[model samples]
Target: MYGVDACPNTEEPPDLPALGTLLVDTSRNNRVGEFRGGAGCYWSLRPMGGGTEWEVEPRHVRLALPIEQLRARTARANARSRGDIL
Candidate 1:
């Protein structure tokens, strides 16, 4: 039997962001979204104004910058005001 250290597939998975945490999907043109959850090796993210969710590889995600977070929140608020989202 191969030891844990000798196993080729023993590499640790990337740490997951907390649910509802804002993140930027770099692979998706830096689209900002809220962390929904993960399955297999993909993470689910919902748009800020609340729309369809998309899956992305963890390697392509990163914490949203402060400005990006503010922008997303502002856009969501605007959508709410416009009754685009509940």
Candidate 2:
């Protein structure tokens, strides 16, 4: 064994996603959001389409998948078309 787990029965922790990208907040009912920026030890995020920004601890959020990003974008577009968001 070369320092590996050797058990071959456990999963490795996922790496943190990049900044200014999409992510899902697990602590908040898997709410989808964008990683707008960082604020010291915390990170700032806003609802995918556009809304008031909120700060979350890094441990509370994770990167958003490509499909999720597309869905959010589409939703935002539809809302804009319907004049639901200004």
Q: What TM-scores do the predictions have? A: 0.84, 0.68
Model 2 segments more than 4 A misplaced: 1-19
Reference-based TM-score, model 1: 0.84
- In candidate 1 the C-alpha lDDT for residue 42 amounts to 77
Q: Write candidate 1's Cα lDDT for 1-86 as tens digits.
A: 86644523345668988999999999999999999998766789999987999999788899999999999999999999999953
What is the per-residue lDDT of model 2 for residues 1-86, given as tens digits with 9 covering 90 to 100? 42442423244434445666788888888878877777555567888677887877677777777888899888778878877752
Tell me the number of clashing residue pairs for each predicted model: 0, 1
**Candidate 1: which stretches are off by over 4 Å?**
1-11
Query: Using lDDT as the measure, which candidate wins?
Result: 1
* Residue-level error in angstroms, candidate 1, position 35: 0.2
> 77, model 2: CA deviation in Å?
0.8
